[model samples]
Target: MPMHPIEVDDDVYALLQQHARPFVDQENDVLRRLLGLDGSPTAVANRVSGGDLRALIDAKLLAPGDELVHIQTRKGLTHRAVVTADGNIRLPDGSTYAKPSPALKACVGHDINGWGQWIHAQSRESLQSLREALRERQAD
Candidate 1:
């Protein structure tokens, strides 16, 4: 891949810095679409519309997954599991979550890096069912 020098304005540069992951994600999506990997919004649109090659050149940005972890906090007093979307764990009680470091492991016998590693849950509803319910209500 050849690198091109395209100068962006200050605002765009700030946006790029602020939303770096999304920009990178959009690029990855474009490449994946070209390779026929499905599931992106643009890829779905391209498949349906036929003449729109926008998905080929387009970039779709989205938020990253949660930063999940199991944490032990405050003088070996309490332990509860939680997942963070942005690595933030500051509670109203003035405590913050930390990844299980060696010191934490020393305090507690067992150590775990993440809660989402062992903690999993799922949503029960689908788009079709939800849409059908909405349509029925609207008809009524």
Candidate 2:
């Protein structure tokens, strides 16, 4: 699971406290149930209902996982992701990130696909071979 660090303000904190009060069993539950979790390390998923969950998610105070990802829209968002064996990115938003063009600079607009643009090979032969291989494979 990926962890997105977020800052909470006093106002939001107070609101969460109020909403989570009845569900909370104690301090432990206050952190858990208020966050609408099963008390496991998996973290609160985006699939949860209610305004409070949305509030927390938009604030970045919480992150939704694989099972809960569809509950949210990640249209223009980008996250630090890793590449798999097939050259696909395991995106933080739980989406597959394809490679980007060379002009893909980190601009304020347009989410950059870092995996797509990052240099892949150091050796000249490897680079040429992979490039040709990918082109041929895609053409077929």
Candidate 3:
């Protein structure tokens, strides 16, 4: 086995960090995954999809400790949570969800797109809108 050093911009580094688990995932593993190579014998990673709110933290659009609320459209119910320091969603019941979807499921007791469901408490911006804005920025 050989090792080499490479340089990437901060954003790319952030993406790599997001995928790399400390003491569990390595840089080579991250790179291999990015290149569509299977470096592990285990099943595929359980990665959260496009609506993942962690991206907001990475992009600095949202910060640790920021408040978010999910307003269930049909039930007219509201659930509140905060972003933990490590970028996980922390609900009032003291459970942490790695992504917004499951947290939302816990809230509404049903399946829903968390991005569209979760709104920033301060900005009132939906996670989907934030994602779209990020995409637009990248496209520009």
Candidate 4:
């Protein structure tokens, strides 16, 4: 899709960022969602609900209530989220994300490799490491 650029002042830009779903939502997506132009609310819900966390949960790599932390050292920011029983990620803002990438995006306002960025709080391991272990185990 071709994207067009538009300018907004800091406040308006911050507002747009506040309503965005991180990596999942571009500015247009947020505007569309807010204006009810993104189809049925059910469709919006479905879009946010599908994620990769369930595979980790099923493989016993992560448990419900586990905390994940993302630290942007250069930016001096640290964001945290918890794993839900259903394998969704629950952000501090009380929003649940089905995947780590969008969850991390919600924190940093851009895309980053979530599997590498989110640290398993207890283990101090990256989600990427856990995923690799799971893959290795499955291949065995």
Candidate with maximal TM-score: 4
Off by over 4 Å in 1: 22-132, 137-140
lDDT of 4 by residue, 1-140 (tens): 68888988999878778877777877787776544356754335546553477788888888889999998889898899998766667776546666788879988999888889999998899999999999999999
For each candidate in turn, the TM-score is 0.25, 0.21, 0.58, 0.64
What's the count of clashing pairs in each model shown? Answer: 0, 2, 0, 0
Clashing residue pairs in candidate 1 (N, C-alpha, C atoms within 3 angstroms): none
- Look at candidate 2 and tell me the lDDT of residue 11: 87
**lDDT of each model, Cα atoms only?**
0.33, 0.35, 0.71, 0.79
Output the worst ten-in-a-row residue range by lDDT, candidate 1.
53-62
Model 3 gets an lDDT of 0.71
In model 2, the clashing pairs are: 99-116, 100-116
Clashing pairs in 3: none
Error of 3 at 39 (Å): 23
Candidate 4 colliding pairs: none
Which of the predicted structures, 1 or 2, would earn the higher TM-score when compared with the native? Answer: 1
* Ranking of predictions according to TM-score: 4, 3, 1, 2
**Model 2 — which ten-residue stretch has the worst lDDT?**
64-73
Candidate 3: which stretches are off by over 4 Å? 1-51, 73-76
